[model samples]
Structure formats: C-alpha cells, structure tokens
Target: MSRLDDIIELIQTTNEVYFITAPGRVRTAYILVDDIIELSLKVFLQEKVYEQRVNCQIDLESASLVTSRNHKDSLRRYFEEKLNIDELSNELGRGTTGVPILQNHLVSFPLIRHWSANDPNARHTFDRVIDDVKPFFALPTTAPVGTPPNPATNLLDEALIRHKTRNKFYHDQNLSGLDINDEKCLSALCAMFDLVDHLFPTFSDEVKSKHTVRCQIGVLRLKQTASLGHRELSQPYEAALQLLKKGHKYDFERRSVEHSLVHTVSDRFFGSLREQFKNTIAKLQVRINKIDTMARPKQDHIDEKNDKEKLIQILQKQLDQINALLGAP
Candidate 1:
C-alpha cells in the first residue's frame, strides 16, 4: 500500500479504538491520531520539497538522494546547493541521517514557512491547505453567523496543542492527571482528517467511509466535496477561461487540465460543427461558380445569386457562434 493509504488505515484503526468500550484507550487514541497527523504532514512536506527540487533542475540521483529513505537529505541538499539558502538547510540538517525530523518540522506551519520562502507555487498550494483547515478554525463572521467560533486560529495552534498534550502523555507517563479525554481525542481525529484532506483530497471518500468514529465537526462536510467529479471539472474550466481572458499562449509542455479541456472541446464538439459549416459553405460556393460559368437568363442568375448570398449570411452567423465559443473577441 501507499504511504497515504497506510496513514489512513492507522487513522481508521484509531477511530475504531476510540469508540470501543475499553478503559485506558482514550490516551492511546489521542496519540494515534496525533501520529497519523504528523505522518501525513511529513509525506506532504517531502512531496513538496521533491517537487521544488525537480523544478529547480536539481539532480536527485546525482546528489545520492533519490529514494524516500534519503528525502530529508535531498531536501537539505536542494535548499543548500540549488537555492543557496544555507541557513534553512543547516537548520534542517541537524538530525542524524535517516532519522525522522521533529513533529514541528514535519507539520504544516514550519513546512509552509520553508516552502513559501523558496517556491512561488507554495502560495497557491498553501492557500488550498488553509482552505482545508478554515472550517476547523472558522469564525462567526467568516463562517455562518450562527456557527461556533473556530477553536484554533490556525493549523499551527492546533498542532502545538496536540503535540504538547502528546508530549505530556508520553514524557510524564501519567495519564490520570492529564487532560486527555474523549472530546479531545475526537478533535484530534478531526484535525487528522483535515490534514489528510489537504494532502490528498481524492482520498476523502475512503477516509470518511472507513472511519468508525462519528463526530459533529463541521469540517467533515467540506472534505466530502473533494470526492465530487463535477467540482474537479470546474477547476479546469475556470482555469481555461482565465487563460483565455489573459490572451496567453498555451504551454503544451505543462499538459494542464485546461489544455486537455481545450483540445477535447475543439476536437469533439467544435471541430465537427466547423466541418459541417465548411461543407455547406463549399456547396454554396460551387453553385455560385456554376452559375457564373453557365450562360443562364439574367433573372435566373440574379435569383441564384440572391440564394447564394442568403446561404453566405447564414454561414457567417454560424461561424460567429463558433468563434464566440472559442473565446474570440
């Protein structure tokens, strides 16, 4: 299974354990949920770092960091060698080789900071990431007026609180006095859903159906939309419209959804319509040519000319419609 699927399975197992009638399981559930969130974030951060490295033309294999085992080293080499950001690289470089970084480094807040500093694509991806979490941290004005205030201001706040609670449980080794409870465990599970949704929106359906715990968190509904195919199509359509408005040349190398939609629409719908129009226009032109070649009565020639002129007008109107759909001014 993929790493994402593994994390999702862990999340599902945690939810099952949280709801089962068992003593001393609430703390375990919380830790499990927190671990899933951290793991999901680590996977997401590694992907972003790798993508940026590839964009910068850094050779992952040549740097001896092609495999997932050496992704942290790859990230360090990329930032230090490619971008020349020695400070960030050195900061990320402190951990021993092959050892996982701390929770803070893998989570959204710190990873987003590093990405935003170095990559332009980070802002767009971060905006989407923030959107996934907004429902969790929504305010009355920002959300519906009757809704409850968002519990945390941002993802960092949520991560910090959960991490602190987890550390207390692990380091202190005393759950009796700790504040971990069913409600807190549920909140952490919800946060895990948000993080996973941000990283892999397409997996939302699988996560929702497989998770056993039922919660009243508002973010669940938002995650459901990610599974919608029509919603996915709208993204490409809107992008295509924006590109059309800007009058920019299409980048064939990118092969974006917009690019595919343009070609699909042209070939399947507009291309066929254009061919039909061309046939009609060609037929009219042939009749006009024949009328000119043959010695017909002046009145007969005038009537044929008028008929050809009417067909030309009709053809022009159809052509205009086609051009309008093609985004011609």
Candidate 2:
C-alpha cells in the first residue's frame, strides 16, 4: 500500500471499535504530517543538490550548496567524498521551516537562529514557506498567506496554529493546550490536508473539471469499442463538466452541514495525496520512457551495446525503486 493508504489504515477515526475506545487518531495524523513535510523538503533538496553540486549552479539559492567551500581543504577532511545536502540538513542551525536554508554549517561557521534577522520576509515560518510553494499547486493564486497570517481572512493561518498545538502535545505530557478531541482533531486534520494540497501539484479545480470531460471521452471510447455508444447517456456529465470549468460546480446536498463538508476530509478524503502520488508516478514513467528511447538506437559496436546495457540497468533500478514505493510486484 502507499504511505497515504497506510496512514488511513493506521489512524482510526472512529470513537469506539469494541468495549474499549480509541482517541487521538487525528492527533497522530498531525504529528506524522509535520515530519513528512520536513522529510519531503529534504529529499527534494537532496536531488537538486546532487544534480548541481559539481558546478554548484542550482537554480534555487541555498546555503547548503555553498560552492565557495569547494577550495577549502580542512573542511574536506569531514566531507572527503562529496557534500551531502542530506547530512547538512541535520545540522543544528536548520529548523523545520522546510524552506531552503540561508545559512548552512560551512557558511555560518557558528550557527545563528535568527538567520532571517536581515530580512523579515525571509523569516523561517511554515506560514511563509508554504506561500512560496503554493503557486506550484493548483490553488487560487490569491489565497492569503503570512507568518501566522490572519486566520480571520487566511486559511493558512491555522496551519501555524496547529504546529503550535502539536508542539504543546509533543513537549508536554501534562497536556495544557486545547484538547485534540473529535471536533477539534477533525478540524485540524482537515486544515492539515489543506496544507498538503498546497504542498503538491495536481489538477486544480478548473484543471480537474477539464479532466472530467477527458474522462467522459475515455468512457465514450470504451462504449464505442463495445458497440454500445449512445449520445444521451454521455451528454449530461460532459455538459455539467463544461459548466464546472466556468466555476459553475454543482453537487446534490444531503444536508446543510454537508455543504461545508464538501471540501473537507469527508468529501475529498486523501484525494490530494493520491493525486500527488499519481503525479509522481507519471513523472517517473516519463523519465523511464525517455531513457528507453535513448537505448532503442541501433547498437553498431561493442561500446554502444555496453552503453545500452548500462542505460537499461539504470532504468531497471529506477523502476524497482518506484515499484517498492508502490508495493507493486
């Protein structure tokens, strides 16, 4: 199963399963999510660092890629092979903001907590960092963001609040903060999912709506293949989808509260995570296809055959890694 499916199975949302009761499922989800964000950033940066460390010409500015240290011999004692961005990520100076760090171990000599003292906008807060990456998502560009940006007007403000709450839960056994009961936990969990939606790329509302038409077209093809095509059977969904693309979404309501729940976990339920994973798989597949195309040329010599074999091995390794993540055979 995917990591998301594992989370769904492990986090019990129900109040009771037998004579006993289970609580704090959403609270656990909160903790896992907090760490996952940090881990994802580290992995993402590691790849970028590996790809650029030789020339030290990464597109993004990061202290971890301090190319100035290339000639420093003493430091080479510790980093004899190559600079490992992943190792530098654990340096005490870096916090969990998940934004690229401005002062790494070599750059600072001695760590400084207030690295953003020079510029306030560059402050390392979850609130601020999410804003930078949100554009990479399908979210409305105008969605408000700040360092603990106004909750009254900003949806992201609560993400910071949840982090504070998580800190309280994590650091204190006495549990002094607001208790993470069902209502509070569910609300916090939904907000965390909103944070996740901002972190990853997938079809936005309009994109997803356009996708709906494509999906219907796929179904229509299937029907045509089976000699069961009918125009009326397909018209209704496609028409609604076209209107949806214009921001005219329609959904039948079972109850009033259900309207508010439409965008919440109750409605979308891990959809963002699944979509992000699907996007990752699509990207890996694209890379694999390109590598295969490179290997498909005529092998006119022993050297060409050796190069082709190496490429195939590299492709197989990537596929194996992806399959392991997917729990595939």
Candidate 3:
C-alpha cells in the first residue's frame, strides 16, 4: 500500500478526526490524528539523531530560541521529510493548510517543566513516536482480498504537481501591470498573504527568522510573466475592445511585477537603512564635539582650527552619500 493508503487505513480505524485547510501557490490539507498509531509514528520519525546541537530554549525573552543549530536546517525540510504534509492532507480529506499548522504547533509548545535539555532519554521519546509509524511509509498492500491491486501513488507528490500548474498560471501569465479591475488585483494580494500563511504559520513572525525582513522587502519588486500565446498582445485598446478581451495574461504579469518590485525595494532600503542614519549621526557628532570644546572656559583656540576643518569635511562627505543613496531611484 502507498503511504497515503496506509494513513487512510489508520484513520479509518480511529473514531474521529479534525482537519484544517490552506490555499496558496500550493495547498496543504492537515488531518489531526489523535490516536496511538498516529502519535507513535510521530515519535519514531522525530527520533532520528540530528548531528547538531539542538537548542530547547523555552523562553524567547531570555535569548533567541534558535532551533536548527546543528540539525537539517530549514522548516521546509521538516514538513517534507518529517511530517509529509501532502500525504497527511489527502488522508484528512482537506486541502493544503495541514502541514503548516503542524509545524506551527511543534514550534509553539510551551517549555515543558520535566523536559530534559540535551538529554538523550528525552530525545529518544521523540524518536519512538516516529519509529512506531515508520512502517506507514512502506506498508505492504493486501489488495482488498484480490480484486486486482492498484499501483501506489504519493498524494503529496501529486499535490505538488497541481501546485506548480497553478503557480505558472498565477505568475507566468503576468497581466498585473495594466489598468484592470481592482478585484482581481486585490485577490492576488490576498493570495500572496494566503500562500505564505498556508506554507508557513510563522509567516508574519518571519521577521524574526534569518534575513526575513530583508527578504520580505525584496518581494515588493517582482516582475510579471506574460500569459501563453499572447505574442500579438498590444496595449491601449478601444473601450468596446477592452470589454471583450478581459482576461489577458499581460494584466496578471503587470500586477505580479509591481508587487515584487515593491517588496524588493522595501527590503533593500529598510534592511540597512539604519546604517545610513548612523553615518549621518556620526558626522553631526563631530560638529557637536567641536562646539562643546569651543564653549569651554579654557578653550584652546589653537586646537579649534584643526577641529573645525575636520568637522566640516566629515559633514560634507556624509551629506553627499545621503544625497546619492536617495537620488539613485
């Protein structure tokens, strides 16, 4: 039996299940398995020895709760390699929000008072959960008592293929830049948020992630991809012509480009914009120091001459850099 079939069979043996769905570039459907079989599988998969120093920091305020220090790195791998979101979604009869929510839950657990830090015993517990269900990944098929066995299929892989098709439609069709209906453009905006939200529950708090703020700002200046078979597409249509040719790929492309560009610029400018501010402040500090020296009761007029020249030169250079950065675009 396929992994998906195993999951479905396991669920069928259970009493009830809860589900969550998320839609975006890809959809993730999650089925909540609160059974012994499900819990055991989780522990087993989590037990694999990670070759890195794992940080089990419970409090975010004390210090940064850095998790993937020596681990496989990346939340994406956690979903695909560990939980297998797509298969889980199919088992639950939901869309795609399943994987992200589980990731969020794992990361959101409170500091367990009895949890041992860096203890192998504690770590083994997680492993055991996954080990119990390792067979789910490779269960043998019984073929329903010989009706003719069907080939196994990984639902997650199928979902990924579907997601790619939708992605091309949304991004490659590139009709975003034109003066089109606000509703479609608005939907794109919502879709962007929804995509991130579905894929990563830690999406907004992505600010806390490595270089996330910079990356998010970078997303503003993206480009659009023209729809397929629109080589003859042109601009400035007549009012009547405009009404007829409503769904051009150019409109989608334009919106995508504009949104991406906005994000790119925001990330580039804001990420290190403070450094520029500090440079300006340093220049001002030189002048302030000179002024303080000049106002002193024992002001050395001889030293003031050198100080004045240095301050003037520093301020001029600072102002020049500021002007250049601002005027660039």
Candidate 4:
C-alpha cells in the first residue's frame, strides 16, 4: 500500500482518525492526539454510562463531540456569524429557527448544515454571526517563529470561511465562487499538513501502528459542513516568489564573477595596448589556419594579412561590447 493508504489502515485500529469531504472535491484528514483521545474517551464512557443509568434530560441530538461544555458559547456564535439564513433556508428546506436550534444541539454533534435564524434582524447580522463562530474558526494565534500555522488548520479554517461565504455569495447573487482546488491553495495546504506532521509525529506513528483509521474522514465531514473557493492562497505564493528572487540574485552574482575573469585576461594580464594587440595577432594566426585549409589553394601573404586585420577589428569591437555590457562601477 501507499504511505497514505498505510496510514489510513493503521489509524483504523484506533478511533482517533477521521476524514471529511465537501463541495469542489475538498478533502481533509485529522487525528486526535493519543493523550487527548484517551482523556476524551474516559469522559465519553463515563457520560455514556451515566445516561444509561438515569432518565436523561438531554436528547440524543443535543449530544456534542466536544467533551467540555465551555466551548459551547463560542460554537453558537460561529454558526450565527457563518450562516446566510435566506440562502441556507432555501437549500435545507427549513425555516430560520431550525438553523440556530440545530446549531445549539450540535454542541456534541458535528453535523454540517445550512443554518438560519427566525428573527430578520438576527438573520441580517452576518458579522455578528461570524463573531459568534470565531471560537469554532481554526486560525492559530501562536506558532513557532518562522513556522506557518498548521496546514490542516489553515485548510479547515479557509473551508469554514468559504462555507460561510458561499451562502452570502449566492444570496447576494455574487458571481464569485469558491475554488478549493486551486494549485497554490492545494500546495499551501499540503505544505501545512507536512509541517504539522513533522512537529507532531504521533499522527503518523499512530497510522503506522494501525491504531488510526482514515482520520481523513473527519476532514471530509468538516468539508460537508463547509465550502471551498478559488481565490488566492495568500502567504505561500509570496514566500515562493521571495525564494525565486534570492536564486536570481545568486545567479547574477556568479555571472558577474565570470565577466571579471574575462576583463582580467584582456585588460590586466595583457597590460599595455601593444602586448594586448600582439595576443590578438596570435589568435588571428590560429583562425587563419582554418580559413586556408578551406581555400582551394592557400591564400597569398596579403590575403592572410587582410584576414588577420579583419579578425583584430572584430575582436576589438567584441571587447568594446563586453566592456559596455559590464558597465563601470
């Protein structure tokens, strides 16, 4: 099997991996760190047993994947800010109340949906909704210096934005559409994933041990919840351009060194114009041999002299051109 396939198989043995997919062929994979999974599992099993022992007040729909209730407020706001009610309502065949209520219940659930609110004013407050969902957004506030944010995180966040923006674009009749498959965008995401994998080896190690399934299924789930778009991938492209510029500068410097050697031979080593002129004469003699070999009978001394003179003139012109090309400091 391929490396990724092997990883997928290994992750299947553990419950920490999942894949997600969405519109525009968007795909994402995620793996819960082993420690985090262990912690969450302990809480999950305890809670699961408690529900079985008691007449639970909470409906199955209200169950959330996040073990902690502290993230609830942030999650609520994220859905509000992200959903375009009018368009989402149209797509989901549900009224405005359906969206917020479902979002509330999804605290433990990871369902992707076209959410909306009953109040027209609340529905119109797109920015407010975004503010609410900021907690759910995946932009990292801290990373090691010189390191970009996690690739999976970046992709997940962009997917969220595009997911939210898609309804707005459609409602506003905007022509712009999401482009998830953009080459640069994909490259940036791939790089980010690679970086994340490098720093946190657990993801790959788990897969190698067959303790993780296709954790990519989680990203696929997220994608179905979100959307993708075609705009620029931003920082990655700029970084690449900067690298190219540095390479160009190095090449120019190397060529300048070669030009200096040519100048050393013609101007410095030859010293006086008389000696340089004699060297040119010697070069002319070598070229004359080739010309005479091509002739029916070797040309007379006059012909040879004329060829030598012409060669000297040509060399003088080339030297001038080279000097011009390598302008004075």
Candidate 5:
C-alpha cells in the first residue's frame, strides 16, 4: 500500500480501537488518536514542502518573473509557520511542534539541495514553542451566516496541544490524579476521528479522472457510514445514498435490504450506454452529410433537414441522460 493507504488504514483501525472494552482502552485510544493527528499533520507538511520546491524550480526553469527574493520570503514562511520550516538556503526543517525526541528523516534531491547546509549566523531558533489548542475553534466575521467552519485544516498545532494530555498519561507528576475519563476520552476520540477522516487523501484528485473520482467517492461513503449514524440499518434515503457511494466497487457484493435498493445488476451499464450513443450519433452524422452533399429541391431539402434535426435532438436528449448520470465533475 501507498503511504496514503497506510494512513487511511490507521484511521480505520483507530476508530475500531475506540470501541474496545478493555479497562485501559480509553487512555490507549486517546494516545493512538493523538498519534494519528500528528502523523497526518507531519505528512501534510512534508507534501507541501515538496510541492513548493517543485513549483519554485519550474518557475526558475521557465524563466518566469518570480525573483529570488520571493523564493527567500516563501522559505521564511516555513520557519515562521510552525510545521513549515526553514533556516537556511540549503535546509528545510520541521520539528516546530516541540516534541522532545524526534527522528528527522532526510531527503536528498537536486531540487531541494538548499537543505545541504545551514548558515551559523543567519539561523533562527526558538527557546520555547507554544500554541493554542485550537481545532474546531472558529468565529467568523465575513462569512455568510450559517456557514460551517473547517475545524482542522492542519492539525500539527492542535496535535501538539493534545500531546500535552497524552504526555500526562505517561510523564505527568499527577500519577494518580491525571484527568483521563470517559467523557474527555470520548470527546477527544470524536475530534481525532474527525481529523483523521479529513486527512485521508483521494488518489488521482486532479479533477480530470472520472474512474478515480468515483473510487474516491466509494471510499468516502464507506468511511462515513459510522459518523453519519448509518452503521446499522440506514434510512431509506440514506440507503439510496449508500448505494450511490458504493458505486462500482460493491456492485458484485451481495445486496441486503439494509443497504441496497435494487437486486438487478447494471453490468457494464455506462460503457454500454456510451457505445450505443456513439454508434447512433455516427450514423446520424453520416446521413446528414449525405443529404447536404446531394442536389435536391430547396423545399424538399428543408423538410428532410427538419426531420433529421428532430431525430438528432431526440438522440441528444438520451445522451444528456447519460452525461447527467456520469457527471464530469
């Protein structure tokens, strides 16, 4: 499995672990959830760093108007932005969460050769790192009323705060009095579950691949069955939705009244529709071309044209139905 697949599996396992009945499961689940949030955040940071490096190189190679000063300022944002990091022309660093023991994995590539060394005098350092435990904390000023907030765009900062609680489980002086309980544990698990769901990546997310988008939609539906409270028997409308989310993956799976509406198979339904439409349209086009090439009376030609147009219009409506079912986006 790819890294994204591994992380997604971690999220799935974390959710299952929350339901374990062991006495220490609460504390164990909390620690595991925190790890999920932190790992996702750090992975996101690494991806962003690599993407920025690639974009900068492309701009430079294409001889775009982007200047070195702009690149330098962009690098500075990494250091100033916590999970974002940089202290030199040759080094990209991350550990802004202030975890005491960290393993810094090094990547060697020509595009990011700036990280090869750091300048002693120009380095930036923080004696202490601090941040608010601010996930799902939002107060909007300009957004329309009733607009929902995006709780955790990047959870590196929030994970750091939650880490403090996790640390108390092991390292705190309050050996007997550490405030770990069902309520707090449940609340944190719910939050962490939500974060892990957000961090799951959809492959082929370029908006240009239909098969992958449908696959992603299927994956999301299965993931959300628990959160949407449809883990058991789904409501009628939700059952329909679940069917839609299942898409091509579960087409061959046995259907039950709990999740499926139809027992009939739509075997190769979309591909068949496309093939049928293409052949009909091709035949119609050939007839129209032949009529246009022939010398006929103007009145006769007009009548034939109108008849052909109506046929084409009817075929077009059928094609529209196909397009609507197989949406472009």
Candidate 6:
C-alpha cells in the first residue's frame, strides 16, 4: 500500500478505536491520533518538497541540504532555507524536547501563503488562527508558575491541550488531573480534521486519481504477452492509450504519461515489433525460394505462394504502424 493509504488507514482505525475503547484508554487514543497527524503532515510536506525539487523549483545546493535531514527536519529546513519562510524553522529553537516539534509548528506555519497570496480570504483565515495557534508552541515556563492553565483560547489551543495530555500520559504513565472522554476525543479529532482539511484540501481526490491511474497501468501490463501477434498487440496498446487518455482527462499535465509511453513502453514494444517483423520476413523469403525451386508448381502451390506474399505485405504494414506509433526513424 502507498504511504498515503497507510496514513488514511491509521486515521480511520484510530477513530474507530477511540470510539470503542474505555475512557481510560482514550488518552492513548488521543496519542495515536496525534501520531497519525504528525505522520500525515510529514508525508505531505516531504512529497511537496520532492515535487518542488523535481520541477527545478529548488536549487541543487538547497535540495542536497534538505535531503540530508529526516523528513520532519527536511520540512523545517525546506521552509526556512528553501522557501525562506522562518515559520516552521523558528519552532526548532524552542526548548520543548519530547513533543513532536514539527507538528506543533505546523499549526502556525503559513502553508498557504504562497499558493493563496492573491486571495484575501485565505490570508484572513491564517491571521485569525495565528494568535490562537501560537500559544501551543510556547514554552511551559511561559505559562504562569502556579495559576491553572487558562481554558483553551481556540481550536488550536484545544488541539494543544490534547497533545499535552497525551504527552503526560506517555511520560508519566498516568493522566493526572486530565480528563479523557468522548467529548475530548471528538474535539481532538475535529481539530485534526480541520488542520488536515486546510493543509491538504485536495489530498483525497489526488489519492483516488493516482490509484486509478496505477490500476489502469497494471491492467495494461497484464494484458500484454510475449507471443503477441500484430492483432493481439493492439489490445494492450489500445489499453495503454486509453489509460493515458483517462489520465489526461483528470490531470491535464501530460508529462508523466508522455514520459512513460516514450521512455518505458515505446522502446520495448518497438524492439519486439522489429524482431517479429524480421522473423516474418525471413520466413516469407524462405517460402518464396522453395516456390521458385518447384519445376512445375501446381496451381494450388501458386495460390499458396500468393497468400504467403500477401501475409508478408500485411506484416510490413504492421511494422510501419509500429514505427509510426513509436515515432521511430
């Protein structure tokens, strides 16, 4: 299964477990949810960085630097050094030790800043949530020494509370002064879903489309055979063509299909077709030679020879078609 599949399954299973487990285990559920969220964000950011690198949007030196770090660290470095956005990078300097620091910083990072720069609503959404999210990354000491932690100031604060609660349960093996209940679990889930919705709004559709393309490619490969005759070969060829057509319908970017067709399938298919044509030509030449050797070739023999010539012509036409498809010289 793909990494995206694993992450989606993790989220779904954790949600189910949270609903069924006893209240005592709800903290564990929350921790599991947090871990899944962290994993998902890391995967998403790493893929984004990879896409940028492949597109030549990231310089070689910066790409080399980011690749050296772990995924989370790579994300932090990319945002800072590559994108020149210090939002996620600044979180690294915070004194917090055990918490997943990258995930903490993600709440306030201007993830949509570049993509939504022209849209005021997107900018406004980030501005409204920024202050609420900032406190989650603040050092514990920054809170009052004796005063009870203030009630969650916003959804971001609520997520932070769930994170801290889970951290306490992990380290202390106890949930002292913490409440683990359906409401808390639901709240954490909502905050996580919200973050996911904002950060990867198109994630589900992208996954579905990719899976469809992958399956179509698999079917094309399976339909192909070593001994495919000219007619038989068309099935797989047309299947591949259909796959490319469907992919173009969904994703207008043709680079991937073009690359696969030209670099992968075309080369192998051209070689196979050329070899088949050569073999057919050689066999036809042999039959024509035998027909010539017949001192008094019968009418039936003549007709058979004519049929062989027609077959040779048909094979030549098929070779031409193959060459056209491959854009071969």
lDDT by residue for model 1 (1-329), tens: 77677876676566555544243447887888767765565566556655554543334334433335455455555454452333333444543432333332324333333443355344343234444434433564546666754444455457656776687865785664785654456567666766566566555555334312212112122122322322332332233345443544554433232333333333332334444555667778888887788775588787987878775665555455444334344
- Minimum summed lDDT over a 10-residue window in model 3 is located at 14-23
RMSD of each: 21.7, 21.5, 24.4, 25.4, 16.8, 23.5
Model 6, TM vs. native: 0.33
Which structure is stronger by lDDT: 2 or 3? Answer: 2
Predicted structure with the largest lDDT when compared to the true one: 1
List model 3 lDDT by residue over 1-329, tens digit each. 43333333343222111111111211111112223223323322333222111332323213322234422233224333443545534343334775564345445432221123223254434234333333434445754555532211232233233334334544775733323232222233223333323333343344323232323322211101112222111111112123333442323343343323323343343323434434544655676566667645354654665655554454344334333323322
Best by TM-score: 5
lDDT of 3: 0.33
Candidate 4 segments exceeding 4 Å error: 1-159, 165-172, 176-202, 209-329
Residue 218's lDDT within candidate 2 is: 26
Number of the candidate with higher lDDT, 4 or 6: 6
The clash numbers for all candidates, in the given order, read 0, 0, 58, 41, 6, 0
Q: Global lDDT of each model?
A: 0.50, 0.37, 0.33, 0.36, 0.45, 0.49
Candidates arranged by lDDT, highest first = 1, 6, 5, 2, 4, 3
Runs in model 3 deviating more than 4 A are 1-205, 210-262, 265-267, 296-329
Model 2, span 47-89: residue lDDT tens: 3333333333332134333334432331232233333444443
TM-score of each: 0.37, 0.29, 0.18, 0.20, 0.39, 0.33
TM-score of 2: 0.29
Candidate 5 vs candidate 6: the TM-score winner is 5
Q: How far is candidate 5 from the true structure (C-alpha RMSD, Å)?
A: 16.8
Per-residue lDDT value at 85 in model 4: 39
